[model samples]
Target: MSLQHFMDTYALKLLQAIFVHLGYVVLCVAIGSAIALVLAVLLTRIPRFSKLIMPFLSILQTIPGIVFIGILYLYTGMRPITVMIALSVYAIFPVLKNAYSGILHVDEKYKEAAKGCGMSSWQTLFYVELPLATPSIFTGIRMTVIYLVSWTVLAAMIGQGGLGEFIYRGVGTNDNRLILMGAVPAAVMAIGLGALLDKLQKKLTPRGIRLQEQSESGQSSGKGGI
Candidate 1:
């Protein structure tokens, strides 16, 4: 279809679907990150439980996306909320794993330094550990957004409309343009969001870590040059 015809036919509906898709992704990621971050923090506080829990979460991550969505829809019926719940659970794993790994790997000496400075356990966590973990945390968040953007299309399977609706219709009607209309925008959204998050991760990452890494690399090269 020509630009004019495509616009005349689908401009408004496409815009609406895009907005719906964005909303779904945003909401799911927010909820998932919050839940995962808390769980990660808890696991860090109680190391024994982490051994037991992390595997469960890893298993959850392995469940097929379509299977989870189908199961949720079966119970909740064809509602956007069902999609939201399913997607949010799927988004939780990366953030949780990163958060757990980042916090757990904080140097014991730095943690002791925090304690020596009169910081309590939680204070040490918030001020020192989390700051050090910012890069990892943000990386997880970026992954969540990208995953959600691609997966939101699945929402249309149960009648919760998004770009998936167009893609589904296009497939059924054998219209390639409609499929592209849905797929191309989704790809753009994923790429755009991923780029934005990359920038965000850089900004949130501690400047000291970057500088230290750069200095370490320089010293390594200087030694090797001899």
Candidate 2:
């Protein structure tokens, strides 16, 4: 197909690819972050468990994506859900590890202060630790999103349609234009989205901790203390 014709014909497919990949990445990050946060919290409460689990998570990260996906496909056998499971699994380690590290690094004095100020354990976490850890956790999540968008191309192997179809089509037919058409757009989308999310992280991240700290501080000053 002519470039213009391809653009016209495949515009929707491209959009679907963009959205599907976007959803895929976002889901992986969300699921990973949720699970990781839970695991990290559990580990924090049980230091001995952190030593056991962190190493296992680190080992999972060491396994190459191809090998991991291959193993999943062998056991789960090439399905859309399997593809998602694989990607989600691969994406979890970074967020989990970072969350654990971030939570651990929260200043002891701050925790003590939060307790001194009458914060409960959960309140201390929500009001202090988690807010401070947002940047680190989000950094790992951002990395996972970028990684998954590119990795989702592998989904085509299982008949999970996306931009990968175009590249596979090109490869099978030896059509250079088709390959370029697919590869270029996918790259542009990943890089562009990653940069945008990075900017968002910077903007949305709290200056120190507690997203509304500046406003809260202002309100406290205005009220002139208890």
Candidate 3:
């Protein structure tokens, strides 16, 4: 199809598909991040359990996206909630792992300092550990958002509606243009959202941590130049 013809034919539909695709991505990330954050915090308090639980979650993460969604659809029927549940579950692993790792790896001296100041466990977590962990947690969130954009395409398999509709339809009919209509937008959306998150990560991370990272990076580069 010619460029003008493709645009004229699909302009409105493409907008709608992008909107639907974006909606699923946002909802999955928000829901997954919240759940993961809570579980990560809890896991920190029970480090032993994480040894078992994290491995189990890692196993689940290895499951193919299509298989996961298919199983959920079979059990839940063809509903939007099915897509949400499947996507959110898939989204949880990265954030959960990163958040747990970040919080766990926080410097012991910081915790000691918080205790010296008479801060309680919860206060220390909120003011010290979580702040220090923000960059790592944000990295997981960025990963989740980008992955979710691509995963949301699977939602169309069960009629949940997204760019996948174009791609899947194109596949059925062997139409490359239709495939591009879905693919190019999804790629752009992923890049755009990832960039936005990069900015947000810098802002959310503690200034001291940022400066420390910059110093370390410079030192590494300087040594490499020797």
Candidate 4:
């Protein structure tokens, strides 16, 4: 078939798949991030809890993507919602763990300053710590989103319907071009989104509190000279 014929036949379905994939990924990321942030905050307050959560998250990470998808499909009887839930579960760990680590690792001096200012625990967390942990949280979000999008193709196996439909159809028909058409676009989207998110993080990251410390030191030296 001509390229035009292929476009005429499959372009709309391809667009639909793109939207479906994007929707699933965004939903998973938003839900996972919220849970991760809350967990991270709780873990920071109780380091022992981090130990408990981290091991479980690590085990979740070990489960293969295909296995997770299949298990959900078997239990949920081949629904798209099952695929979404499975992907969300699989995407949770990195964000949760990283957010916990990031908030906990904020410099002691900043925490001290917040306390000295009589900031309550909640106020210190919202005002002093979260902003400092933005880069790490962004990292976790980026990773989770990328993984969610890439693994969504497996959703097709359960009749959940996405770009993977094309892959499966092409395989059934032994059509190399159709297979490439679906696979290539999905890969491009995953990498493209990952890069865009990384760029966003870099632009948004603060110039570290270390910059403030350096400026203070320089000002003190000039005052001494004066």
TM per model? Answer: 0.93, 0.83, 0.95, 0.86
Ranking by lDDT: 3, 1, 4, 2
Candidate closest to the true structure, highest lDDT: 3
- Give the 10-residue window scoring lowest on summed lDDT in candidate 3: 198-207
Residues 21-112 of candidate 2 have per-residue lDDT tens digits of: 66777777678778878988888768999888888888888888778778888888867777788888878887887888888898899999
Q: Rank the models by TM-score, top first.
A: 3, 1, 4, 2
Who is ahead in TM-score, 2 or 4? Answer: 4
Q: Encode model 3's per-residue lDDT on 21-109: one tens digit a residue.
A: 99999999999999999999999988998999999999999999999999998899999999999999988999999999999999999
If both were scored by lDDT, which would come out higher, candidate 2 or candidate 3?
3
User: In model 2, which range of ten residues has the least summed lDDT?
Assistant: 205-214
Can you write out model 4's per-residue Cα lDDT over 1-226, one digit (the tens) per residue?
9989988988898999878877878887888788888888988988897788789888888989888887777788778788878887877787987787789888999999999999998899999898888878888999888888778888788887777878888999999887887788888888988999988887777776446647989999999999
Per TM-score, the best of the predicted structures is: 3
Model 1 scores a C-alpha lDDT of 0.91
* Pairs with backbone N, CA or C atoms under 3 Å apart (clashes), candidate 1: none
- Candidate 1 lands at a TM-score of 0.93
lDDT of each: 0.91, 0.80, 0.94, 0.84
